[model samples]
Target: MRVLAAMSGGVDSAVAAARAVEAGHDVVGVHLALSRAGGTLRAGSRGCCTIEDALDARRAADRLGIPFYVWDFSERFREDVIADFVAEYQAGRTPNPCMRCNEKIKFAALLERALELGFDAVCTGHYALLVDGPDGRELHRASDAAKDQSYVLGVLTAEQLAHTYFPLGDTPSKALVRAEAAERGLTVAQKPDSHDICFIPDGDTRGWLADKVGAERGQILDRAGDVIGTHEGAHAFTVGQRRGLSIGTPAADGKPRFVLEVRPVSNTVVVGPKEALATAEISGIRATWTGAPPAAEEFDCHVQIRAHSDPVSARAQWRSGGVTVVPDAPFDGVAPGQTAVLYLGTRVLGQFTVDATVSAVAVDA
Candidate 1:
């Protein structure tokens, strides 16, 4: 089989490409240049598309004796990932740029290009697996659940899955991959993982957005409409955030207040007790299913509101271009624009963007 490995100049992708070669398949390395000049610093150290990263990928390709090339997808990336991220925030919605990248860039654009270039499939270092199931190709959690990235990849369409390969799905821990790189005499053996978003290298997403859209000073109010402080921009804050609120007043109970909501139009940030953030039900927009939409009215599943959050028991119902999730237990600070990924056991069923939440009924009512 011929495979086009998506090398990101990291030990994981390098090892994934090497593993493909050892499996007796023809392989080529391709790195994506997703950033333009004056790109924002990455969120964590785990960034991609840096000049150093491209050079590392080239070196790995040379060591593997496979043909390699750099594909400039910066324009498409800006359109699909970075621009969408800023737009989502400006619209009072939290967007996951990585998920968008997988859907629009990696699985769609890159996969299409690889097929046009006569490659059988495209490979990546994602810690997820593809298995042949009764229905068809199925995506499963990786062996190392701690590192499983299926949540971000849950948005892939069925057709996209048909042409994708996750070579590191069954590989050992990330530590093992680094060790293997050292054993093979690769320079990036000890390179720190890229933890930050590729476009925002410094991890200052709010500052970046403020610079792009222009800051709007707004009033910080309590639930009772009392002005407590002032904010530079409403888009700079998110639900559950506690720092940089600049609210001088202490709570009636003398506890620190947290951000409860962001009103973009009025440019107001609502502050309240932490308990005020709890909600029973959440609604989402732009829900995408791996296969066809679910046939049942309500299904038992586990829902994850954030990338690092543990799955919680919930009931899901499909609505118009969206889904509503009611957690069996109250979830705190369910923010708008964040993704709610659904899972049936270890298989990722689908995901959607949070739109709103339902308050629990009062005891008297």
Candidate 2:
């Protein structure tokens, strides 16, 4: 089998590409240049896809003795990942840029190109397993729970899953991957893993959004719709945010308040008690399955809302335009635009983009 290994200039990807070579697959390495800012350097692993990262990827490809190339996907990335992120925030929804990148750039765009070039699969270092189930390929959690990335990858469709390869999914720990990289003489063995949004390397998300969306003075309101304070912009806040809210009026009970909602259309930020963040139900659109769609319209599964959040036992139903999930217990701080990944034990059933949430406390009342 011919494999296209995505070398990200990181230890995990370097090892993943090397493993693909060791497995006797005809492998070719490619580094994706997601940004045109070639002079930009990674800020101690806060961001990725910088020029230095591309160079590192080239070096790893050299060590592995594979044909290497850097593909310029900057325009596509800006349109799909970065632009979508800003637009989602501007519309008062918290979006995961990494999820968008995986869905739009890596799996969709890169896989399309790889297939056109006759590669059997596009391999990466993602910490998620691909298992051949009765129906077809199924996505599963990585063996290392701490490093499981299946939640972010839940957006993958059945077709995408069929052409994806993860070499590090079965690895026991990240330490072992680093050790393997050192043994393979990969220079990125001691490199720190990138975190936060890659485009905003400084880790100042609020500042970054403000620049993109253009912050304006907005009213901060309570559940009763009465103004409690003022904010620089609605885009700077998201549901369940606790700190940095400059509210002049304290709650009646004198407890701290949390951001319950961001209404971009109204240019208002709603603040309330923490309990208001407990969501009982979630409704999502843009559903995608890892393999076959569920056989039943209604079934039991585990729903995970965030990359690191624990999955909650839930009942899911396929509705007219989307899916609805009712967790056995309330999920704290679920927000619209978040991805809800359904699971049956370790197997990922599918994912949906959350469009609405019903508060558990409100429902109970």
Candidate 3:
């Protein structure tokens, strides 16, 4: 089998490529240039896809004695990930850029291109297991729970999972991968893991959104629709955000308030007690299955919202356009535009982009 190894200039991806080579898969390495700015440099592991990273990927591929190339997917990335990110924020939703990258750039575009080039699969360093279940291929949690990435990858469809490969899924720890890289003489063995939004490397998300979405003074309202304070912009706020709010009126009980909603259309930021952030039910659109569709319209499962959040037992039902998930216990601070990954034990059933959430705590008019 021919494999396309996505070398991201990190230890995990380097090791993943090396392992692919060692497996005798006729591997070819490719580095994706997501940014067109040639001078973009990584800021202390805050961002990725810089010129330095491309060079590092080249070096790693050379060490593995594989054919390497850098593909310029900056335009596609900007349209699919960056633009969508700003649009989601402007529409009062918190978007996970990494999820979009995996869905649109890596698994979708790259995988499509790899298959067109006659590669059997596109392998990466993602810490998620792909098991050959009785029915078909199933995506599962990685052995290292701390490094599991199946939550983000839940957006993958059955066909995408069929062509995807994760070499480090069963690895016991990231330390072992680093040690392997060191033994293999890879220079990125000690490199720090990238965090925060890659485009906004400085980690100043609020400032970045303010600039992109354009700051406008907006009213901050309480549950009863009474204006309690003012904000620079509604886009800068997200559900469950407690800090940085300039509320002029305090709650009657003197309890701190959290951002319950961001109304981008009205330019309003709604604040309420933290209890209001508890989500009882969540429903979403654009559902995609990891393998076969569930036999029943409703089934018991586990729902995970964030990348690192624990999966909570839930009941899911297939609706007309999407799915509705009712967690056994309410999830705190769940926001629209987040992806909800459903699981049956270790196997990922599917995922959907959250469009609506019902609060566990209802407010009195």
Candidate 1: Cα lDDT at 166: 90
Candidate 3 clash pair list: none
Worst 10 residues of 2 by lDDT: 356-365
- Which stretches of model 1 miss by more than 4 angstroms? 38-46, 360-365
What tens digits encode model 1's per-residue C-alpha lDDT throughout 1-365?
99999998888889889889989999999999887673443334656788878888999999999999999999999898888898888887767888899889999899999999999999998999888877778888888878889988988877888888898898658788788888887788888788767777777888888899889889999888889899999999998899999877777789888888888878888888777778799997888887666789689999988877889999898867678888999887888888888988888888888889765633222
What does candidate 2's lDDT look like per residue over 229-310, in tens digits? 9999999898999999988777889999999888999999988889999998999898988887788999999999999999
Q: Looking at model 3, report the run of 10 residues with the lowest lDDT sum.
A: 36-45
- Could you give the C-alpha RMSD of every candidate to the true structure, in order shown? 2.3, 1.2, 1.1
Error of 1 at 338 (Å): 0.9
lDDT of 2: 0.92
Looking at model 3, residue 227 earns an lDDT score of 90
Candidate no. 2 TM-score: 0.98
